[model samples]
Target: MQHKTIADTMNLTIDFNDIDDGQFADVIEKIRAERRALLKATQEKYAKSRAQKALIEQQKQRLRVQLQCLYGAVVLIMLSLGWVFSNLEGTTPSLDEPGITHRTIEMTRDHRLDGIQLSQVERYFTAKFLVGDWRFRGANVEGNGITIHIEMPQPLSLEPHYQREYIRNSLCPKGDSELWLSVEPANLTIHLYSDHPSRGQSALCAS
Candidate 1:
């Protein structure tokens, strides 16, 4: 007898009442085999999809680490540049306009004279001021001391102020003894007498 088989997309329904036992067994085995093959194919496809997802996640993690490193390097470079600029700002001087320049000439204990002499002080001031392209205009030797004038190619702004203190400290190394110092600005001149009795007396006794 012939069996009626209802075929669907993924399964077959057999009416066993009209079929022989041996044919029915054969059809059942064929269906079981098809089911096993389909299940195996489905498992392989799922495993491949899982592997692809894992590879994509790994790539994303690597990219994230690289971006973090790049950002850190950029920040470090910016900090370095800021430090360099701050240092430059401190050292660099403003040159908006020409400023006054001045210097003080004084004698230490090692270079003290018994009596203050204008000519000798003038020579000392001249020698000190006539360095590094500085033109010595002239010296005015008065009863108190001498005032030496100087000329420069450019108007002084920063260096002279610092040099004034440095020169004072260097010339008056021996703080105990009295010393005569002449302060002459680029535009004005002043005579200063030492506080020591000997030098003060000599200045007062000068004709």
Candidate 2:
């Protein structure tokens, strides 16, 4: 069967042979008017559908932007939390040691002295005690540095045993007696251990 417009259907249903020429023309014009109305209705429907699709697309784009911003903020918060926890975990608290303690050299590798010679150091002590007419000799230098073996003319309080500590503890380089000294006495001979060398002519101890 062939497709027919409203004009063709109406012409087939009406008895045009019985109608006058003027009436036939009037019926044809009425069919043409219906065709124009149908075309306009179809165009209006298409325009409404196109506008709906554009509105939907705009809404979808706004939703995508909102999701992107939410994701970025969540990522930033996670990074900030990680950094705070890491710093908290790595931190340590400190405690103090009790007493009025002096600083000590724990590592002896660099204990060797370059500022002064052992011979020059000996002369400093020898000349210092000459007022007491106490004789001084270099005798020997201990294995490394910071110690010397000396012989005096008298016992100089070299009593039996531990009493030597009292004398040594009280000793220091001449002008700076607050500096530490230790003595090992055997008769008139004493082994003086210090942070060694001295002030004045010797550059070891402070002035």
Candidate 3:
């Protein structure tokens, strides 16, 4: 009876509970592995996208800087051009005034000497004076036995040579004539009555 009971119990039930447990464990492991792989792939994609975005932002910043630099350069150039044009416009002369001017001269002689020879007088004048618009308005001179008065158009001042070559050349030659002047800023009315006809023929004064 005991042997029979054992056989019957063994044969009575063959439960599939163990197989169910093994199958459940395998499914859980597979799900976990898939989750890990998916997470890794997502991380890689996110990192790549972040790097690309950073590069694009850097390029944008560089372009912005270049554009700003170009704009600044253009502004500076325009300012320089404007200044040049303004100076050029201001330097031109007007048309209302005359181009040339002239003057007259008066002469005198000493009274203490009588019967003065017409050729016995000898004199010289020297000056470095500022120039004016009219002749005697700005000039300087000194000498014995002669007096002079004259009107002029330019100042007695010396003009710049290299810069104003055309104007400097236009003035009468100096240093060669005995009665010449380095123009100044004054008007002296005097007499110049020379007894010497030979001296009268020479250059008495110039502007």
Whole-model lDDT per candidate: 0.44, 0.45, 0.37
lDDT of model number 2:
0.45
Of 2 and 3, the candidate ahead on TM-score is 2
The deviation in Å at residue 53 for candidate 3 is 2.3
TM-score of each: 0.39, 0.37, 0.33
- TM-score ranking, best first: 1, 2, 3
* Comparison by lDDT, 1 against 2, better one: 2
Which one is best on lDDT?
A: 2
Model 1 gets an lDDT of 0.44
Whose lDDT is higher: candidate 1's or candidate 3's? Answer: 1
Clashes of 1: 0
Cα TM-score of candidate 1: 0.39
Per-model clash counts, in order, read 0, 0, 25
Clash-forming residue pairs, model 1: none
Off by over 4 Å in 3: 1-24, 91-207
Error of 1 at 187 (Å): 18
**Per-residue CA lDDT of candidate 1, range 131-205, in tens?**
776544444433234343344554434354444443344332133422233322111232222222122111111
